[model samples]
Target: MKILLLSFILLGLYGFCLGAGGGGVSSSTSSGGGSMKETEDTKRLREGRPLILTCEQNATNLETKWTKDGNELVAGDHIQLFPNTTLYISTAQKEDKGEYSCKTGSMTEPKIFHVVELTLQKHLPKSTTVLENDKLSLSCQVQGDPELTVQWLKDGEPVEDTDNSTRLEMSDNEYDVPNAVLSIKPIQKSDSGNYVCLISLYSINVNTTTVVRVKDIYAALWPFLGIVAEVVILCLIIFIYEKRRIKANFDDSDSDPAQDVKNNVDGKKENDIRQRKH
Candidate 1:
């Protein structure tokens, strides 16, 4: 009877331990699963900013390791690991982008904690100019995810395609990068203002603004007129200088004609003296 009683006690303890162990595993898995969804919706990271990621498991004394594309991450100057399973990057760069996974002790598969992707937007001129009745094109290039949306705005209002004269064109290229161009054929002076390119993807929205100035057709003529005036003024100055130089030469010659005669008589007298001495 005592042996049967001891067997029953052993079975009961085994069952209790199994239940506790299963419960703890379930709780940790639940916490990690919740964070996986949150990480999916994370906003795009900007360059030159700190990037931090934390493991969300709720278990005590858990061993967590971070990896990128299956390579184990080592703590260094730019990368740091905290005791709480958190990773810190001092400054985010393009090369530091990839799939980052967090794994716990003896896990068959790592949970993707975050995917680091950088949005690279090309720069536009701060101020652009267009002549009246001339064609102008402004291109906005964005590279990253394919689902990016681009929109153009003018002075806080949406730009419209009017009669096909002013329209936007998207490029279909081999590399599949998103590119948008705003074109105005035969642009008018009324088209001058602040133009903005707004790019959006998921939870991230970024924009760049450019000021456009339109000049009149006659506005180009002013520079030509100024050049002609300069040439005319230079010719007048040369003419005045040449006329004064000739007048001064004529005056000097006429003022000393009598001195010229006296000089000729002195030269003959010296020549006769020299011949007599010889």
Candidate 2:
């Protein structure tokens, strides 16, 4: 009976210890689950733009520390830190993308840690000029997260690549950014407008605009017309100068005739004096 009672007590203690161990694991998992959710946050920003990461904890006057890629971040020419839990990047570069963390806490409370995966989206602005009845091509390339959807818009309406005059070429492979080319064969004057390359991923959307200017066929003739006008003016000036020179020669010839007649009368008087002497 004593041995049986001892066995029951031992079994009871073992179950109690197991229960205590299970409860501790459950409590640990609950706390870690919340931290995992917080750490899984991510943010995407456009390159060459400002990025501001702020902590929204209810605790005020908490000391905050910011770090990027396991290194502490400090204020610099392009980076700024606020008294509040805010990290400001004046201009985001490719090197600025990485894991960022913000820790905020007071002396009495536990520190709250937040982890964000920072990513930068890239786009290049373009400007194109095509002459009338000439081929036009504009390339719109972007880099970002996968599942990128691209749309080309002229003015405000969506561009139709199926049109006989327009063609759009896209990359066959899947990419985080779209590699698209918009082409218009024999582009017309009416096609001159803003062409926008819009990219969307989930709820985020970004666009880059290309200003397309169509030149008229007669645009090249403008310099030719200016040259023709200049030639006409030069010919007019030469013609007027030649006419004035001819008129001056005619006036000098008319004065020469009077001088010739005066010389002829003087010769006759000299001949008469010679004959009287003989």
Candidate 3:
């Protein structure tokens, strides 16, 4: 009876220990699963470049599985989990832009994530307009994380002149300062044409054209001279009218004196004749 009681006690103790161990393992798995679900996802990519995807986890030993648009990625696409947990595509095309997800074996569901969309865009400079004979300065602007290089072109030909007359200046900004200043001293009429500025970066080129019209200085001067001539003619007309009026007044005064003298003589003769008749 004593031996049987000892055996029963040992069996009961073993059962309790096994149950406690299983419960501890279940709790640990549940906590690990919760942590995987709460993992944060971040994605970023440059415009017109390849896309990069990343996965992260709070736990150190967690395994990560990557999928794209509900399809399982092959061994080539599987990215190992790290602190940063990033994957790179050599050249991200438009077709590769989509949603992605990551999951661990300890998690119940996959964590929804996204891949940065790589879009190729062409950026040109602002269109500038200036009066003829004045300095023409223009700059091309492009916004991106990485700075861009700028180039200048005139009428489909690259401007080879770098002697401050037609040169491109570089800067570390997306929009470069007036890198190119076209100085045309005493602009001639022949300078009027399509002035084009071409900006190139990473095999992508953008062009902007401005129609420059070298206004004929004579075109503006002729009208001004015409206005001045009209004013001078008007002043002469006013002076001539005043002079003619003054001359007419003087002539009328002289004629009045002669008429008065003749009238007096006639009256005296009439009186003498009347007296003789009487």
Candidate 1 vs 2: which has more lDDT: 1
Best by TM-score: 1
Clashes of each: 0, 0, 4
lDDT of each: 0.63, 0.59, 0.48
* Local accuracy of candidate 3 as per-residue lDDT tens digits, 1-278: 34654555565555545433321111111110001011234244434565555555335555567778898764454233343445566655555545678776666877766543212233222223333454444333333222334455555554555223332333333333233334444444455455565543333344555554544333434444544555566667668888999999988777677889999999999999999999
RMSD of 3: 35.6
Candidates by TM-score, descending order: 1, 2, 3
TM-score of each: 0.48, 0.47, 0.44
Best by lDDT: 1
Model 2, span 1-278: residue lDDT tens: 34654555565555545433321111111110001111223456558878777764354565677778778888899888777777788888767766677776643442333222222233434456666777666555544543456777877777774343344444422233444566677677788777777666544555767677777766655555555555566667668888999999988877677879999999999999999999
By TM-score, the better pick of 1 and 2 is 1
Checking candidate 2 for backbone clashes, the offending pairs are: none
Clashing pairs in 3: 48-119, 48-120, 50-92, 125-140
Runs in model 3 deviating more than 4 A are 1-133, 161-174, 177-190, 217-219, 256-278
